[model samples]
Target chain A: MSAAPELNPAIEVAGLRKRYGVGDTAVDALKGVDLTVQPGEVIGLIGPSGSGKSTLLKCLGAVTEPSDGRIRLSGETVYDGGWHDLDPRALRRDRIGFVFQAPYLIPFLDVTDNVALPLLLAGRSNREARQRARELLAALDVQHRAQAAIAQLSGGEQQRVAIARALANQPPIILADEPTAPLDSERALAVVRILNRMAQQYRTAIIVVTHDEKIIPTFRRLYHIRDGRTYEEAGAGRDLG
Target chain B: MISLAGRDILHSWGKYAFTGLGLGLLIGVTLSMAGIYRGMVDDGKALLANSGADLWVVQRDTLGPYAEPSSLRDDVYRGLLGLPGVAHAANVTYLTMQARQGKREARVMVVGIQPGEPGEPRYLIAGRQIERTHYEAVADASAGFQLGQRVRIRRHDYTVVGLTRRMVSASGDPMVFIPLRDAQEAQFLKDNDAIVNERARVRANPALNRPGAPGLAETVSRSQESSRMVNAVLVQVAPGWSAAEVAETIRRWKRLQTYTVPQMEEILIAKLIATSARQIAVFLLILAVVSAAIVSFIIYTMTLGKLREIAVLKLIGARNRTIAGMILQEALGLGLIGFLVGKTVATLWAPYFPKYVLLEPGDAARGFAAVMLICALASTLAIRTALRVDPATAMGG
Candidate 1:
């Protein structure tokens, strides 16, 4: 496994395992899960409650260490049995982005700043970061709300701004956890459409963790996790474009 | 990077303003307490300065006319003036009592001094000094006395002939100057009934009414009715003589407790008001602790309320230091506003207090630094909580 060539997969995992506690109290949250995502691809990860969907997302996001796994991003091994010599915070800032169930836009920041935050954390000049944020906001069709406060935006607009923020750093991978849990069918489909467009335009791989039945049919490929194990399947491939 | 603390404060400025206002009032009271202590010390110094005395000759082994009771013969100034360095010496008495004017009564320190003496008030802001020794008085302006107004002291009514400013006692009581003879009579005069009873008791004693000593009873009665005791002797040193040198000569030769101006100041400030100073210090310490506790509670609660947002920030790659800095900055901002408000209110209300309140710039500067330090210390609790937020918690596992 150590001699494997760098295939440049946006995100890849094999035999990822996460166990809580030790001895009799030990419980496995993820049991030898394997996954792969190609560039410019948007994949759906769906599962029932307590089925380790979030556990897998957490492992891939580099927010938590896996007990045993081989993980790679952009041809670099991030976790091989144990985490490599990389700052996890820098990994999240420069190589990965996250979207939550709620837009979770920083309440105090306007649209532009909320989008520019990741770039700022990555040591970009304020002007350059804000300029990059503006360009992304324009691409997301939310340029008109660049200076609007988070509370001023409608639910769908807030979600679009959140997507812009996730794509701000140009990360190779984005982990969106239930990105449309609060939206109706129309807004939910619109969010999925935006995510797909952003992934393709930016050449980024995105994994969307969701329980929304309405948007399940849109993905070309899907991963279903049951009891800490993943089963891959082909989706309905609905034409969302 | 955009200032997360500034944005958060601006977002909920109303909450911060109200909280700061409450804390500011507490700070205001703390400052005022400190001001009162300073005022007391200044009053003690002023009293010593206005007396225009180089040395104070008090009774042997006594603290003095201010801190303790000290009685000397009224003729003690005669012997003190005979000393080599003594330019002029005057007997003086001090008694704290109530002065009644019409329907109001004011607490005043009655000072007995002879006309043209070192113990007289240095300057008068209004009217003339007392010319008629028996029924004339000079009062401090704080006593609310008007010229020619009759004020009752003891069993006699004396007209206020002059008003002086800042002529206060060590305890901040306004000084009222009267003739030494009148003050002596007032101090020792007994009620008519008591005097009559004393006379009968004396006549009834066979030893005192001895047939061989006919005029002895009359002489003893006359002596008992007269008061010749004074509290202290105020002395002025001649040119080319240091007050310390003169005071030391009096202490050694006259067998009396003598104090130079600086030594008297020490007695007045360090000894007289030491307890009060300690009390204010304790109050300031308690207020500081309370302010810190309040700031900690508020910052901790505010941070706890943002736990979810903090998780999201951490997950999005915000460093621990950055998050902690945000919380710390908010606490400091609150403290700044509170200090400004507290200083303003304390200045505005200082003059209305009964005792003088001296708000010194040095004290204010020290207070501001203390407030900042307290705020910084208080923010640590909130910062610690924010730092402990696990980024993985954002995944809801």
Candidate 2:
């Protein structure tokens, strides 16, 4: 097997645009947005409601098609004008990881399977997938709850498992949308600390889209999105310890 | 790959089992309806087989002996016995009425057969065939009669001498074989009050009670009270002769309607119980449709409940077929559980039915296939819903 290419930026987007409908009734959700995140970096994307944070997250996650854009993940172009790869589903499965506002752990699956699902979907053997999931859970400090049901976990524990699931495939980048919105100040900051630790440990680039102001100071870099456009800025970069 | 549907079912087994049980009862009723129809057909065949006859000779232009009423002279069997290729022939009478033993009563087919004749029950499970011509009777075990038990026909009481199995008519009424003379009297005899009223009316009428004819009133009254008619003559063909040929011979010379075994079977199954079978078929169809609807509604609701989960799964790159397969498998699993429960319950309760319920294995296999097919078809609605789920929904607006 070939080793992964040494890429500086885990995800790069240039001039991304997304529009709903057509003609007079159309609304542009994302307009020529440009952003990039390097490996081993945790950045924050903060915006008010209806300011295209979701639209950007969806475009970056490879779920919704961007009307026009160039998107590269781990030094490979995934979308240029239209998807360069025909199977966006496979691209998403192999390349992208997602963390949602709620834990959104599959209720029927136990923690291990929920975390292992991405690897399984990637056609890994069950044992290998489970081994990888356990490793992630251990790193996330939720290994003790690996066999527990999603319903049996606290909100913080559920979010931690969700993080483990997002890291299951060892993706180069993760898109987190409002992941800390449901957490308290301490737990939200704790989640940010975990995210930073995971990013450094796995060399992953994570973009957290949030309205939560509690964890904003922890990001070394932040992007402020307004009216479908983003402006990059340096953050307080406060110590999480 | 992990089985999402299996895990879901295992996690909520209690809910799925309860739902399966409810569906199972409906399926059980549907299977029983099919069994009832089969039983009717089997009863007809058994009736023909137990009669030990190759041809049935009834009144001309009638579908008789079982499907319709036909009256032939009591001496018709002697003429049938003399025909070429004739082995043995006997007079038989059949009347469906309430047979009572004290206060307990059952609807039974009263069969009148000569001792050691063609129409006698083929085998006895208990006791012996009727030895006396007057009041001895042989009863089918399904009639709930015991040997030596006294059963009352219309006017006289008779003792059950034998018990037989599967000796039932096309309608599933158990047979109670009595002597020809007794059955004739019971079938034709009128009540004493009605007899007296008829005699008085006849005497007052000059046309019936002529003063010039002294013995006319007595003759008229004797003729009114006597019955020398038999329902049909059961004939056995010789070993070398074809039943159709013998039936044709009888129809030509005897001037009576003759039916070979197959023809008789057609009449009993196709004509006698046709309406009842159609009714049962309609019921089975309705139950199948209802089962499909219930399965569809349940799967659709379950899929709707998992909308967010489905969205997440899709966003995480689970293929559309994978999601659809999960829903389809769940529906099939539900159907399998329901079918097992249904078959068990149907078998357990079949004997308690008033008529025989025949649950043939072939029918069960077909039923299983049908249930699976229905479940698969029913899951399509849920699968479509799951597929339509937007993965972007998981990103949240």
Candidate with the greatest TM-score versus the true structure: 2
Q: Where is model 1 more than 4 Å wrong at Cα? A: A1-7
lDDT of 2 by residue, B41-123 (tens): 99999999999999999999899999889999899998889999999999999999999998999999999999998999999
Candidate 1 lDDT, B92-194, residue by residue in tens: 9999999999999999999999989988999999999988869899999999989989999999999999999988888888999999999888777777887
DockQ of each: 0.69, 0.78
Estimate, for each residue in A26-56, the C-alpha lDDT of model 2 and write its tens digit. Answer: 9998899999888878899998989999889
Error of 1 at B207 (Å): 3.1
After TM-score superposition, the amount by which residue A226's alpha carbon in candidate 2 deviates from its true location, in angstroms, is: 0.9
Measured by lDDT, the strongest candidate is 2
Candidate 2 TM-score over all chains jointly: 0.96
lDDT of 1 by residue, A1-241 (tens): 0112235778889899999899999989999999988888889999998898888888888888889989999878999987799888888888998988888888888999999999998889999999999999999999999999999999999989989998999999999999999999999999999989888888889999999999998888899999899999977678886
RMSD of 1: 2.9
Q: What fraction of correct interface contacts does each candidate retain?
A: 0.61, 0.79
